[model samples]
Each structure stands twice: as structure tokens, then as C-alpha cells.
Target: MFQGFNLNVSNESRFDSPSTYDEILKSREDNVRESLENFYNEEGLLNGDSLRKEWFPEIENCHVFISHSSKDRELALKLANWLYHEFKIESFIDSTVWGFADKLLKQIDNKYAYREETKDYSYEIRNYTTSHVHMMLSNALNSMIERSECLLFLNTENAIRNISLKEDREQYTFSPWIMAELQTSALIEKKQSPNSQRPFGSLESNKTDIESIVKRAKSFQMIHKANVEHLNNITCENLSEWAKDCNGEKGYNALTTLYRDYAPGCR
Candidate 1:
């Protein structure tokens, strides 16, 4: 955790004396300042390639990847923690796992420290635009998705608003990162053998029966309205269809249903 502010470190003797407590607090503040300075000097700025190589290696295994907008980081973390506690499922949230990106972004925004007129600011901007930041981020995300068993997209209001489907096209054109992750998950699911894993049910199960259930799900359209236009070209077998099937009007009952049907063993 980043610790640049004064810390509340208590000792039995210090707690009895206000002056001593104040002195301890001041000491902690000094230590924190020194640590922060050293951290910045060590990490440097605008070194995406080196950061990527050192920080994000590779995720060999994980149960799920929670996809959400940066705005909903708290909610995403809450969900990840809950999933791990309830079902013993390991999950990845970018804020925690890929925190170097967050730190770099924060450093960039610290105008007082790295003044806009300084060469550091120019170098930072140039690297953000021309360096391997995007590529590294994409690679890291794809690696996580590739290793995970499934993706749990947190469809909160913020996430939906950020990546709302376009009316004109049958494909997602906004929120490139979310769209890319979803497409990657779809591709992974497609590559898996139909008989190998049956999270929802047997692929050989009655097609007519599956279609009937899907039709019923679609009937809830009034409550859970999605961009049907975007879903037109997607096959019935696609996981996207499962998401559409589970969307209810208010809460995520439909999402629960989708998970129950597809990833049955998950809590």
C-alpha cells in the first residue's frame, strides 16, 4: 500500500503521553516521506516496457477475471473478495494485480511534483503515446483472460454506461479494453471442445430445449432490455447470449441464472 500520509503507529508508553505520541507521528511522517521519495526514484517514470517486464509476469491459473470500468474499482474489489471467501475462487482485478499502471497514471497526474513545463512531463506524454504501454497492458490483460476459467463482467451502471452498445452497428465499437477482453473470452470458449467441459450442460443436450429456454429468457425483454441489434450475429451457443439471457430488469437475477446454467458449480 502507498503510505505518504502520517500513520497512526501506537506504543503503550507513547499512548500515555500526548507529546510522545506527537513525536512518534512526526517520525512516521518523515519515514513515509523518505520511503515515497525512494520509491519514486526506484520506479522512475515512463518506463512501460521495463515495468511490464518486472511487474506483470504471467498468471498461470485463476478461477475468474472480473471485468469492470475503472470507476467501479471498489465494487469490483468487493466482488472479488466475496467470490474468494465464498467459493475459494481466485479472481483478478486490475487495480490490485496491475497496480503499476495505476501508480504510473497517478504520477502523471501529479503536476506539482512533475511540473508540466519540465522535460519529465514531455517524456511522460511521449511515452504514453508512443511507448509500449498500450501493448503491455493489452498483453497482460489477455494473459489473465487466457489463464482464467471464465470471466465475470460486473455490469454495474458505471460499467454499462461506459461500454453501452452502439445502435448503428451489430458489434461493440466503444470501451476498447472491455470489448477486447470479452472478444478474447469468446474466442477462448470457442476453442474449447464441446465435450470437454459442460459448465452449463451437455452440448449434446436437446437443441430445441435450449432454444425454448432462450426464448423464454428473451421474453423478459421488457425488464432486461439489451441491444438486441448487437446480439443478432452472435451464435446461440455464445457466452454473450448467456449474459443476455440472465439480464433481469432490476438486479442481477438473470446474471445469477446465467451463471447457474453455464458455470453450475460456482457459488
Candidate 2:
């Protein structure tokens, strides 16, 4: 359990220098490159466990889980990099997991779910496979959210849209994955760290055209309120202050700085 925040951040905001941001992107690319090797085994077969590991995030270095829309991926990446550069706080971006889930599904369907006779994939088997993969990915995301000390949701226009249903204005998100993440953040057990004596804080949808998965998401009535009222709503300005507070501090103390100013009530 941890603290969560909904930040109405500017997508254009650049928190780190160009070179520094490039370094962050390079590092992420390198990490992905390494993980790519694990997709196959000695027999050149898709290793299910290895693919599963991609969704089952065991990120020891990450203290934050960034939840945002696929369109705001660059922004989320920038925020994650900023957290690391400013406060040495690593963050887990769910976009990567979504990618891996797609890859895993492609590998499975290409291998087993296809039918040469019909010149198309077996719809039933594909559905069965996707259900399992999505379940794992969803559970893994929940796990990451629970394990991290903070969750920062980038409440940008790209993430949510305003809808007026019968004169009642409400927020609606197109992606069911985002809906699940927000709901999980809302209901998950809120646990304070042992060091709460100090302070506190803080998915992308599938891209594959596999059986028109995205179309199915659109058919669902996922009307969310973009409920961040319960969370501490912070701005880029507040983040700057948090950075200033972190200037003289080190390690966990720097993180505590955020809790002190924003989540003093957490114990």
C-alpha cells in the first residue's frame, strides 16, 4: 500500500535537460533489448514463464508506478526520468508491460491459435489465450501499484475525456485498461510504510489488432469520474518544490520530504 496522486500535468512539460532525457530513453531501450532475448528458449520456442515475467514486475529499484494514457507515453517517460534525476526515485511505466503482453499474445496465436483450414486464427482459442494473458497483466499491474510507495496518475486530456450524459457531465476513458488501473488504485489496501513517521505520495491498452481487441473495449460502458478527489492533486509546481526539499536530503529521506508536505496524515 502507498500514497497516490493525480497530477494535471502539461504534456509539453520538460523536467530534465535534453541530454539527461536522452540518457533515460537510452537506458530504457537497452533494458528492453535485453529482455527481448528472454522471449525465446534454446529450442527457439516462446518461453511462457519468461514472457510471464515481463508482466510480473519485480522492480526492486522502482518506488513509483506511473499511470497514464498511451497517447501520453512520452510525458509519462519524461516524468519517470525526472523522478530519477531529481530524487533518485525509480518509476514503473505500465506501457512496457502492455507491449510485452501484446508480444506474448502474438507469439502464442501464431504458434497454436491459428487454423490453416479457415485461413484465420481460431477465435475461441484466441479468446481463451488472451483472457489468461490479460488477467496476468492486470494482476501484475495491481501488484506493482501495491508494491510501490507512490502512484502518480498523469491526468492529461489524452488520458481522459469530458462527456455529458443527459446533462450530467462526467469523465469517460476509452481504454478499459486505464479504468481497471484507476479502480484498483481506488480500492487497493492503503498501507503506510514503517517509516511513515516521515511522509508520503503517488496502463496502456493493447495495440495489436488481434481479433479487434480495441473495438471490444469501445463497446464497453466504462464511464469513470476520473476520481482523483481522494488523492492529493499535485501540479508540476508542487513537484518543483518537492525537488527543492530534496536538494539537501538523500535516499529515503528525500522521498519522505514528499510525504511530509503532501501526505503528513499517513502513518
Candidate 3:
């Protein structure tokens, strides 16, 4: 992904980089776009050729529901971004969409008053999606849940487990078909808490480089903070290790000087 040994990776987003690993590997952009495009064309799942086409989410039965406790909204958004950009997955969150939809509805009904003298008038009708557009979105959302191969819950395992498609708030909001469709969904837990993992390369890679990093006289603490500044100089093993180590420590010292942090005290 970093453009490897022989060439420089054109400083573009890693997600957009060319796969170029081998003749068989497709470029990242092409791969993601193909996954999205083939969703309608190849399988006949969406049955294209309509004059008015809407956004057809890929991943059959895999309409990714961003299930998270209200506390994790920020993290949920971040996860949604990654899922959409990295995996070309469909991620729908109600946060931004709800706000915009609400504002539009208010403007249409309240702002344009037919009566100049009275504050109240004909009815407070809200501007909403065209029936066709609403139906399209409804079908897409339901299809996402129905054909969903997997379900990604953002740090809400307990809530998701306790959820009832038959008699729950979620079920009440969406139609019965949509709720029932979630039964086929399989949950995939990310498991890494924001404060837990360092969010970088794996840990085993760091084990091998710990000896060299120590030999180089860098602070053992600095080596483990998961800084991307000297990323090329460190191995993933140590970084993941540090993040894991840091998860429970009272202070910075508790994070460093673990058995894995040193290699025979050459320093």
C-alpha cells in the first residue's frame, strides 16, 4: 500500500492507490467501483435499465446498519467513513441525514405562510422525498438488510444482542420486512476500543525491530507511542504491542519498559 520498495506510492490516499502488487491485482479504485457497479449489472439483483436509477448499495443482504449506543456517535461516523472508503461498503448513519431532512421539512411547511395576518394557516405540511424517491430509498434500505451478508455494529454488542426485530423501537420505525430481514445478518465486531489499539500496523512486526530500535537509542516510550512520524523506521509488532500495553496504565511509565520493550539491555 505504501508503494513498496522499488517505487514511491504517489502520495494519493492509500485507498485510491493502484494494487500493482502483481498482474492479477486490480487497482483499489477499480476494485471498489467494480464491486459497486457489478452489484446491479452482473447479478441482475437490482435489475437495471431504468430511466430513473437511484443509488443501489452493493453487498447482497449486507445493508450495513450503523448500530451504536448514542455515546459512540463520533466513532460510529469514523467507522462508517472507513467502511465506505476502504471496503466500498454501504454505510448509513442517521446523524447528518436526519438533520438535513428535518431542516428541509421545516422550511417547506412553516416558512411559506399563505396567510399574511395570521401565524397559522392551511396545514403545516412538510417537504419530503418524492413518493418515487421515498419508495426507492425504502426498497434500497430494505434490500440492504435483506441481502445483507454481514452486520457491522459499532461498539454496541449488548444493544444489538438485546434487540428484537419483532418488538423493538427499531422494528417499529422500519417496516416488518426490513426488521425480519435483519435475521439473516451476521454481526462482525471490530473489538478494538478507541483507547485500546494504537490504530496502526500489527504487533509482531515490532518484536523483531525492538532490538534495532533499542540499539538506535530511541526512548523506549517514544518507540511505542505509535507515532507515524518515524513509521518507516519502526515495525508494526512494537507499535501494536505498545498500544496494547498503554491501554491500562495509570501513567506513561506503566506503558513502557515491558519485557517486550527491551532486548538484553544493550542500551
- What would the per-residue lDDT of candidate 2 be over residues 69-139, giving only the tens digit for each residue? 98888888778777777666667888867877777677677677876665567889989989978988888
Q: Model 3, residue 144: what's the lDDT?
A: 44
Regions more than 4 Å wrong, model 1: 1-50, 102-120, 123-130, 162-174, 189-260, 263-267
- In candidate 3, residue 102 scores what lDDT? 32
**Best of the candidates, TM-score:** 2
Q: Tens digit of lDDT per residue, candidate 1, span 1-267?
A: 000001111221211212222332233223321112333435465454445544454443455566765776655555555444334445566544445544444443343233434323344554554334467777878777666544566444544432334553232323556666656655553223121243321223344654675489555611122221211121223333554454432122333444454442434
lDDT of 3 by residue, 1-267 (tens): 000001112221222322232221122113322122333455445333231232333332222454333444555455544334333344444232323323333333343433445434244332232333344444544444333322333323212223344464231212222232233232212221122232210134344554564477433311111111111222334434544655454221222222225322211
The positional error of residue 266 in candidate 1, measured at the CA in angstroms, is: 13
TM-score against truth, every candidate? 0.47, 0.78, 0.29
Higher lDDT: candidate 1 or 2?
A: 2
Residue 138, model 3: Cα distance from true site in angstroms:
4.3
**Residue 165, model 3: Cα distance from true site in angstroms:** 17
Pick the winner on lDDT between candidates 1 and 3.
1
lDDT of each: 0.43, 0.72, 0.32
Better of 2 and 3 by lDDT: 2
- Give the per-residue Cα lDDT of candidate 2 at 193: 50
TM-score (C-alpha) between model 2 and the true structure: 0.78
Query: lDDT, candidate 2, residue 234?
Result: 81
Clashing pairs in 2: 4-202, 5-202, 151-202, 199-259, 200-259
